[model samples]
Structure formats: C-alpha cells, structure tokens
Target: MINLDGALYPWRFRLVIAVLLGMVGVIAWRIVDLHVFDHDFLKAHGDARSVRHIPIPAHRGLITDRNGEPLAVSTPVITLWGNPKELMRQRQQWPALAAALGQDAEVLSRRLQQNAGREFLYLARGLTPEQGDAVLAHKIPGVYSLEEFRRFYPAGEVTAHMVGFTDIDDQGREGVELAFEQWLAGVPGQREVLKDRRGRLIKDVGVARNAKPGRELALSIDLRLQYLAHRELRNALVENKAKAGSLVILDVQTGEVLAMVNHPTYNPNNKRNLQPQAMRNRALIDVFEPGSTVKPISMLAALQSGRWQPTDTVEVYPHSLRIGRFTIRDVSRGGGPVLDLAGILIRSSNVGISKIAFDIGGESIYRVMQQVGLGQDTGLGFPGEQVGNLPNHRKWPQAETATLSYGYGLSVTAMQLVHAYATIANNGRMVPLSLARVDQPANSTQVVPEEVAKTVQGMLQQVVEAPGGAHRAQVPGYHVAGKSGTARKTSAGSKGYQQNAYRSLFAGFGPASAPRLAAVVVIDEPGGEGYYGGLVSAPVFSKVMAGALRLMNIAPDNLPPPLPEQQQAGALPGNGGRG
Candidate 1:
C-alpha cells in the first residue's frame, strides 16, 4: 500500500487481465461451434456407428383342419448372422464360435471365406431360443441374432401330403404350402436399435413398421377322419408290402375331401426324410386302370341307354366269351346259370358287362364316362393333379369296348374315381370337390337321373351283401355298397399285362340307403399270395368305412344279426373267391 503503484508496471497488469479474458472468449466460441455449427454432423457420424436399423421378422400363416385343429403353424425362433468382415478379424475365436454353434471350425472358415465380400452372412437359421441364447452367451463380436419363424407340423406324416411343408426361410415348397404361398407369407417390419461398439444390441429405439403376420388357412379335411384313414391305409400298405398306394374319403353330401392319404409318406418336420417318391400325393397325382370298379358305371350307362333294364339277362355261366381276337373270361368255373343285370355286377361278370357295353354301343359307354367326370381334373386345385387318360374313340371297337366294360384301356386317378362314386351317393349330382372348408352345401350338377343313381346304389349294395359277392367289403354294422377291382399291371418294356403284378382297388360308399361317405382305395403291386381286390383293398374299405360311419354318426343301414354258423365256424363269407 505504501508503494503499490511503483511495484508493478501498468502495461504488465493490463496484459495479464487481457490474456485471461482472451482465453475465456476462445473457449466460449468453441462451445458455440460444437453446439451449433457441427452438432448435426457429429450426431450423424455417431448414429452411423451405434444406431442400426434391424428387421423385425414376421410369422407365417397357420394351417388348420375343418375343426380348427392346427395342422401347420409357426414358432418364433432366432437366426444367427454375422458380419463376415468383422468376424474374420477374430479368427482365433473361430473354434470357440464353431463349438458354440455346433459347426466345424474348418467349415466356418470356409463359410467366412466364401462370403468374404458379403457384409452379412447367415451362420444359422431356425435356431431355438435356447440354442441361440447359448451361442449368444459367448458374446462373440460381430455375431448377432435376429428373430425368425420356423414351421412346425403337428400332424406330422399323417397330414404331410396335404398340408405340405416349408423351407428354412419359411417359404412354402410343397402341397398346399406351394398352392397358397402368397397367402401364407407375411410382411417384415423395421426398427431402429442401439448397439455397442462390439455390435451387441443395447436397446430398441422405435419401430418404423409393425410386422404383419400371415393369414390362416383352413382345409376341408377333418383331423379325426384323416387320422382314421391314415392309420388304416398305413397298416394295409405295410401288411400288403405294396410299392405305393392311395386312399381318398369324400363327404358325399358336401363334396369335400374328408381324408386323402398316400403311402410312403414323409414327416414335414423332418428334413432328412425328404424324397420325391415319398412325398408324392398319389391319390391326385397317380393314375391307373380302374379294373372292375367301373362295373357299376358301365351298368349305369347300359341302363341309361334305355336299351337295357335291371331285369335284363346275360349268360355268364360259360365264364368266357370270344370277341374278335380277344377272349373275355370270368373267374366263375361252375357254369350253366344265367344272371340278370344286377347279377352281373354282383359277380363282376366280365362277359355279361361286356355284352351290355356292346349292345348299348361303345360310344354310349364313353359318353356316360365323360358325364361322370372321368379323364378330368377333380377341381381340388392340388399341385401336380393329373388329368387321367380317357381316350375319346370316335368309333368304338369290339375289343376296346370289351376292355372298357372290364375297366381297361383307360386311366383314372383315385380322386376322379371317388368323385364319380360321390356323384352316385349324392343322388346322381356331381359334387364339386373342395380341399378347403366350405360354408355352403356343395354346388352339385346332376350327372345322371336320380332314379338311375338309386338303382345303381342298390346293385352295388348287392356286390357287398349278396352271396358270391365282394364279401370282404361288408362292414359289421353298415350296409356297404362297393366293388372290388383286380387288374394286372402292364409288363414293363413290353405290351401285354404282367402275370404277377396287379393293382387291387375297392370303391363305393357306406350306409347304402342314405350314403354319407364315398371312398376309393388302390393298392399298387401288393405282395405275397394275396393280390385280389376283395382280399386286399376291400378290407381296407371295410375298416375305414366302419370307422368313418361311426365317427360321422351316420345310422348303420345293416347291423349283423349275431354271428352266423359259418362265421362262428371260422368260415368268413366269400373269404375264398377272387374279387
């Protein structure tokens, strides 16, 4: 205080204060630049590093039976993916990563090399949440997981051919899955997510679009009936040692397919069992000569021609008829008995039916077959459905007409055959087949006069009920109406029919008086000593029909009146004859 002014220079004090103020000004300007001018640029760069737009996987549609039972569905799963560029840098950790993923280290290395240029690579798909979490627990950098969906088939091989299957990407690849892929697929959404520098997800910021799930599909098949058909058909196929087979059950009233199954099926859930031969939907895809199953239709045609009546007569006692260079023979050896029109169908007389076809003219038979929907698509919209070969002969030859009477020289699918039988069951009206559930009664068209259809039903009932009939086709509590057809398959690399290989078939409906269901069973190349339709295919029809009649609550038209003396003596009715 005595000499303060003399102790310091004025310019030096001013310079100290000025220097401190300049530093503060410089810092304030820097804050302004960072907060205002460069704020958006820095924020964008930071977002590029830590904020990521991730896809939200959508779920596929469901497939259900007529009763809303889930046949096919999708479950949420985790898909492991990685940035090859970033993952390759952590080569030392590859063994651990592969171990966690249950993949070989060498394989992982090759995969990385294969996708070196790819920014993202799929490590695994359709992994269960547990599996994904176990791998994620390792916290391997650049390895991330995204949500996905995997298809699960609950009915397995029982409904495999009909419900079909999907691929790893949830893409429908077979059967109904392929038929309705568009309707079964969903739309994926996007969301912004925050991640750490190691690429681990931190938090979801906001959703851009919510995922839209696929729509559900309902099929016409009842799971209960489908199960019954599958069990019976599978058992029969295994017992017969057949190469392949198909069985189709139709709701005669509604024309809806209740159950359609194939042999040598594959479980859709298991990818290892996939084979073209096993996955084929034989009922709709494969065709064969219908054999004597067409006898009812031939009689229908004969009666419709007005040239013949149910009371007409033909001499089939001789068991053989010479027509041109071909000879038509019956299995009946005991001769000299004339049969009426109904008797011809009951015994499945080739000679008698051929006479009717020849007298009525072959064109008439062909025309009636056309009206019955033979050689045509069944309108099921099934993938790979075959339009069978029904040659329209402008002029009918005697030999061809004889073969036609016995169900040869033409090919038909099981679906088409059942569709015809359903027409008769539905009172001569051809029912429109449906694979999906329907809300209304089938829109049917009268393919024949209702009276003719009823008459044929009565005659077909005789084929199962009468003595020397297809007695194996008779059910315990129902008046089964059907026919057994045994036809020799054509020899491979040759023209004539094979002696051993046969296509055994049975087709008809149950509760003959007021039929509720129509079905067809075809056993291709059955093994062992039993190859006749009555012995092989008719039994399947009986068991399946019996169950279906009970399940549908249809009143039995004929309950047996206790065991007969022959049945009690272990001599089943008509158990020894050819179909």
Candidate 2:
C-alpha cells in the first residue's frame, strides 16, 4: 500500500513543476509585448500626457545717451503659470494654495476642472518679486513663476520721445523703441524637464531653444542738452500761457540733433493719466506758416541766382500793394517809396519781400525751398513726422505766390525750417540731421556756395541789429544771425488765417564768426506784452544761446557794446545804419 501512494505523489509533484514553468513563459511574453513590441504606442501615450516646460523671454537692451547715461532700461519681473494636469491631481490642497495667492478656491477649482489635463496656462503677469516669491514658496504642484522683464524709463518725460516705451510683453510701442523693435528685442529661451509624480522639477534633460538678448542702442543725443531744452521749454510754456511750444538745438557742422523738446509733454513712466495730444511731438509732427523766418531763405535765393543784391533797393509800393486779388502790407506803414532788400528785412516789410519774390520768380524760389529741405521730412528718423504741404505752380492761386513769399500759403515743419537755416549757418554745407551716432559718408553734397551762405548770414545779423527792427533779440556778448517769424495759424479746411492765433518763431546761430549751435524756438499763440518773433522768441533764443556758449566754453565774438544808458548816449536810433 505505501509503495503505490509514493508513486502517485511523485507524479503529482512533476505535474506542479510543469504548470509553474508554463506560467513563467506567459509572464515573459507579456513583458516583451508591453516593453518592446508596443514601444511606439506607449511612447505616443507618454508624449501626449507629460509635463512640458514653456519658454521665458530674455532681457531687453539698454537705451543710452551719447555719454552712456541710461535713458530707458528693463527690470526683472515675474508671471504666474499653471499646469492644469497637476493642479487637478492635487485638488485637495486647492484651498490653501488659493488662499495664499489671493485666488478663490471655488473659482480656481472650476478653472482647473474646465481645463482638466491641460499642459499649461497663464495665471497672472507682471507680478512683484515679493508677491511672486510668496506664491512660488507655497510649492503647490504645477504652480510656478516665469521670470520676465518690464520696460522702465529712467528719465521719465525727459526722454519720452527719444527712448520710447514698451508694451507689457516688452515690445516697443513708440519712439526709438518702435522704430527699431527687431534690433532691441531678443529671442526667448526654453527648456524641457522631467517631473516626479508630484509635479516637482526632477532634472533638465533637453534644451528646447536658446535665448538671445536685445542689442543696445547708443544715440547721439547729449543728456545735458536734452535736460536743458526740456527745462527751458517747460518754463516758456507756463510763462507765456501758450497753447504749446517746441525747441530744437542742432550742431551746425554735423547736423546732429543736440536736443529736441516739446512742451506739454507727458511722462512715459506713468502713462495711466496721459492724454493723446500731450504726447505729440510738435516739432516734427505739426506744421505752421513760417512768416519772416522764411525771409532769409528767399533772400538767399535772390542772391544765389543774381536776381538781387543785399543792397539793391526796390520801390515797395508805399504801404501796401495788391497782388492780384490780395493786398500785401508791412508791419509799419512806412512813408517811403523805395526800400533796400536790407531795409525790407530789417523792417520785416511784407510788401518789399513780395517784390523780391516776384522778381526772382516763384519757380526759382520754390526750387531753392525744395533744395533746402522745406516741405519734406528732414530724415531725422523720428516717428509720426509729417511732410508738410508745399503748393506747386499749378496749384498756386494769384494770392498764393505773394503770400508764400512772406511764409504763408506754404507749410513747413519746425525741424525742416531749422535744418534749412542750419545749412546757411554751416556755411552752405548741408549735412543730414542725425539723432543716432553713425558716421556719415566721406563725400557730402553742398546745398549752396560758401559765398552765398556768408552773404545770407551777414544779412540776417543786420536784421537783428537794424533800427526799427523787431527788438528784444540782442545778446550781450555774441554775434547772432537769424530771422524772426510771426504768422497767423490758418484755420482748418480754410485758406484764411485764424484771428489772434499766431506762431512766434526765432531761428538763429552764434557766435556768427563761426557758428556752433543752430537753435530754433517756437511758441504757439503767445499772449500778453508782444507776440512777434523778435519780441517773444528772440529773448529765449539769446538766453539759451548764451548758456550753451558758456557751457561749451565757446569764446565770445563781439561782446555786446555797452548800452547808451551805461555809456554816454552817442548814436541816435536808426543812425547805426546797415550792418
């Protein structure tokens, strides 16, 4: 009986061993199916359901003045981001996370629920360091901060037009920023990371892309001059009770813009309260009739073409002359039949200038105007610059020609007129106006002959020093040459001047022996006392020019002679004769 039972037991043990071997084979086959045979399928599933890292923006470039003073810059900021997949996984901790971040738990829950399994989403942007650090310190799964940059204007309203401001994402919106966005903005960088089951960053295994920063811009503007111009213009705006004002200072030789300022300017820093009109750059964007400031250019054209001499006298039809349907009048009703070109300019005689323009022919005068950069952009690269209107021969009505001769009927920008005046100040050499510091080509074109420029400068100085000339422009210690402009602003859509609305302008350069700074100042509708360019704008020009000369250490040319009051009254008025 024992022998038979033992044989049965041995057979049963052998059967058990065979069954275990079969089960092992099946397990190995299943492992091979999942790990190797279905590798592609598993990889696709993992790719579709994984934590992905997005890119963060790089720092922007610096905007500095010629002296390396920072005009515009950027500071690091933070933005909150979320991984909906992880946020949903840790739904139990939502209350604590939302409380610390000032987010409603129920709202966050709905947001996460709605975006279930989403890889990435934005929470908030432009957060402060402390605020961002508090949220990041919570260590909530899927919630993180992205480092970024926000634009900062160091000089505030002082450099608003030059440095410009950027949008929230660091894109340029205006000024130099808008003009050179591509060069100033940089590419963003990215990284891919593997997270643990808890959504904690494990290790960075691969780089998605490289980051590039913006290129720095170095402008030709001098910060000192910019501040000076801004201060003066602001004071003028307040003192004169003006609608607006603009001032520009240029280097006569290089035509580089030392300073360009517009009053009623808004600060680029806190733009929350800015108005549309306050941010406008009036110098380049606005146009006005230039009046007698244009007289010098007309006279220059006459001398250039041998049409008239600075000394040549023209009979100025008494007080007024009718040109076609319009009557041309002078500032003063002179009891004179004849007046020299010098006398005409000195007296700011509208009728005398009309005769000169008639003799030179409108075509020649218009050609000279074009050559001198009138009725066009000066190529300064400023944004929103308007190319002002210049009526052609076919468009010029009978009254147009005469009115244009005295700086009406045609429109010009302050910068264009200043640039044209600078060409004469630079002794006929017309260099393009530059706001950025790039070397010009070796060969520069000449706009007028040297003698022609000299002749014009001489005539302009006489206009300031002449008797019965518009006064208040005399500087104590320099020989200044320029023209005064007092013209009425034309009504919109109408061909007539606006009553009591005048543009007062003074354009000049000193010390006259060798011009350094060619400056222009314009006041819109200055009231009280007098509004003529000689009375209103010239005093400002003298004050600024004197300061500029002192700052640059430019030696005085002819220190103004002592006043007759200071000394014995010798020469009677108008007896100084022609300069």
Candidate 3:
C-alpha cells in the first residue's frame, strides 16, 4: 500500500508460481506410484469386476503289463462346478437353469442358497459323457463343466489287488496307484479365458498352457499266467469249501512275479459290491505259521552245518516229542523202523526234523532264516506288507525251539516262504526279488553252500515221489521238488490249537534239472474229508506247474521221442535200444 512498483508485482507472481509447482510435483509422484511402481496392486482393483478363473485338470496315465496289455486306464469324464456367489445373485433364475440342466429345481435351489459368499464349489464329479454335454449346453452364469479323467480297470478283479484303484478325484488311493503316486500323477496346467461384462465367452487372448500326461507304468505280471492262476484258485475255493485261498508263482531265476491270485476277490470297477475282506491281498499281506514248508529251510541249515546228510538216518519216535511242557507230533506214524533224513522229508516226520533242529541249535537256524529274508519285508513294493514274526532266541521258551523247528512257533507270509524256497532252488544264491523288471544290477548274498542246496533239493524231490507224501504234486512230464504243510490254527490266549481249523500249504518248483518257477498255494480252513496239505494244495501245484511249463515251452529233460505203433512193441523190453 505504501510503495507500489513493477518489482513488487513480479515477486508476488513468483510466490504464486512456487505454490502451483509444489502441487504439480505431488500429483506427478502419485501418478508414478499408481501407474509404475505399484502397477500390480492397482491392477488387482479390477480383478473382482472383470476377471474370470477356471481350473484345468491333468490326465491320469495308463498302467499296462510288460507286454503292453492294459491293466489300468483312464476314460474321458466331466466334472460340474459352480460359483455360489454368482449363483446366489440370480437365485430367482435358478429354476430356469435347473430345468435347462435337467436337474431337480429344489435341489439346485438349496445348493445355490447355501452360503452366498462361496466362490467355488463342486456340484458333481465323474459325470457321464451325455450328462456332461447337457450341463455345458445350459450355459448358466455360475455353472461350468471341466474335462477330467476316471480310472478304469480293464483286468477287473484279476489285477485289482496289484494295480489298485484311484479316488473320485483321479488321485491314486491304493495298491500300485498309491505306492507310485508321484510317477503316476501328471502335472496340471492353467489357461486364461477372457469373458465380457455379460459373462459371454470372448475370443482367446493367447496360447494355452498344455498339461503333461502321467508316465506309463509296466508291471511284471503275465496276463496268461494271472488268468490261469485266478481261475484255478476260484474253482479250488469253491470245491474245497474253504474260507479263503491264495496262490503265487515266481520265476526262481529272475524273481519276477509271474502270477498272483487270491480268492473271494472283488471287481475293482464294481467297488459297490466289495466286502471288507475281499479287497485284501493275502499273498503279500497275511502271515501264517507255515508248517512243513518251513522244513526245507531247516533242512538247509542242517545240511549247511554238516550235522546231517541227505541219506543220514535218524530214528523217529512214533507219536509225540516231549520237550519241557510242550510236545511235537506227526499227523500219522511213519512206517519205517528208522527214518533217514530223506525219509523224514518224505514222511514229514515232525519228531525227526525237530531232532535235526536240535543238533543245529537255534542260532545257526536263525542266522540262515534272517539271511534268506525271513522275519522281514520282501521289498516287493507292495502296500501294507507284513514283516512276519520270528521270536528271538532270548525270548524263546524251553519248548519254543522244538516247536519252531517243526514250523510251529514262527510265522511267515506266503511270499516270504516262496522266496526262501526259491533261494534253495537258485543253488543257495539270494536274488533281490522284483515285481517290476528294469535293468537294475543284480545283488546276491550266499545263504547256504551250493553243495548244501543241492542236497536239500534232492531230498525235497522224494517228498513228492515217496508214499505217504504229496504224490499228486508230481507232474507227469516234469520232475518236481516241493514240501507240503499242515498247521492247526492257534487259538487266542494260548489255549492251544483249534480243531478242524487248519492252514494247508503246498510249495514247489519244477524241471528239477534246472529249476524255473517256484509256486505256493495256501488253503485256509479246508473243511473236508482230507484236510492235509497233500490233499488240498498239491493238486493246485500240479495244475499251476503244468500250465507254467507249457506256457514257457520248456522241453522236459531226458524224454525220448514218441514211438509209432509198430515201433512201440520193441520199446517195452530190453530191446528198448532199437527205438
């Protein structure tokens, strides 16, 4: 007011310019943050309003036999999902959607009304191909169809216990499926599909991410052998009227599982009809006291210890062995004055074998058993495999050693017993057992001397040829070495054995010259006139062995060519050299 001039005017203008500059700088900094530094946070603002997400499922893989025969496969399936939040906003329109989808309106209304805040919820899984098409045709705002896979068992119950089944979500749930889930399940992929404001599909933006299918699996089971074994086991169970039965055939040279069969089986595809026990894999999971089949193992120990020879004679008491408070006895009295070691096997004399065990003592026998992979897992990659019970020497009572000597006090699974016998058949070499074949290197440990194994193998042969033994186990064209077992099922609380309840077993291998396959058949509670292993299990061995031999096309050793009718006349006499 006192001095008005041009300089004062310019200074006042400069202050106003400075204030305007500060406001512009603040706005520019905020613009940089929102558009550049915090761009993702700003973009998230539009997610709820403009973006739509969908799930993509990966394809499950196929499980096949070594020869490419399908065991497990996946068929095309569809799943229905809904966004509850979107559906609830149009609750009144649910009836229209329900009618178009051919579902009950009341049910759809209830599902849509449940917790309006839910973003994703499954409506139905594993829909039939036709039903899936109908759901897609509806084109409802919240409902969608996703392509998926469903497990199918082509071999049905024949391969169920080995291949196993998947859960509803196509995840491995049991058997090989669960055991090799990492290898069997594929990696899932994702895609982004743009939608308009009205929820109508628009053009694709870019390339889609493809899912990787699961890796294919090849198993060691042979289809022909598996079928034959299953058929025989089912018929045998019905004929014997037994509670249950199981059989396994192993390649003694390769340790590959040729066949595995269990009775009271259920179709994995039709799981609704399955019973609790029908699903059990008895061959690998269940353990029982293997009566006389265990005799061969003890014989190996005895021979290895040089305490007994194949022909060495030992007098067997007619009835029972009184050891402390317990007594071991034979089913029937042996007919000879004194039984040789070979005679003891032929007659299955419990008393004589127990004496052999007594000579070898508990320590040597236990060491051999452990070395041959008893009282432990078989490492076959089976689920729920039991490690059989073998009481320690320190825990054994005065009578335990004698009873165990005759295969009473110890327990073993069918696979374990088979492997032990296969070790003997392989000339004392312990091959790592395999269910699936690969190029893995072989590892072996000597369980017994080669001489000892040969001696035991020879003695086991007489069990099938001699009288009062398992003659039915003998194949006409093939020489066989095997042992029969019959053990009474022990009762609870140590009250002694149960009457008429027995586990009958026949374990053997054939061609005797060069052992090939070792097989075992276990029949539980065969309530019939003949409850012995010779009667119940030997015939199964014959059938399985004959089939296995024929399947492999192995020529029988030392067999002459068939003679013509005219040439047959000279073959019956000492003129047999004339052919």
Local distance difference test, each candidate? 0.89, 0.81, 0.82
Cα lDDT tens digits, model 2, 325-437, are 66788877653778887777777788887877877777767878888889977876678888898777855454666777789878888889889888899888888888776
Candidate 3, residue 120: lDDT: 79
Candidates' TM-scores? 0.86, 0.83, 0.89
Best by lDDT: 1
Cα RMSD for candidates in order: 10.1, 8.9, 4.6
Identify the runs in model 1 with alpha carbons over 4 angstroms from their true place: 1-53, 193-203, 333-336, 492-494, 560-579
Give the Å error, residue 50, model 3.
Answer: 4.5
Error of 1 at 266 (Å): 1.2
Q: Per-residue error at 545 for model 3, in Å? A: 1.6
Q: Any residue pairs clashing in model 1, and if so which?
A: none
Worst 10 residues of 1 by lDDT: 1-10
Question: How high is the lDDT of residue 23 in model 3?
Answer: 91
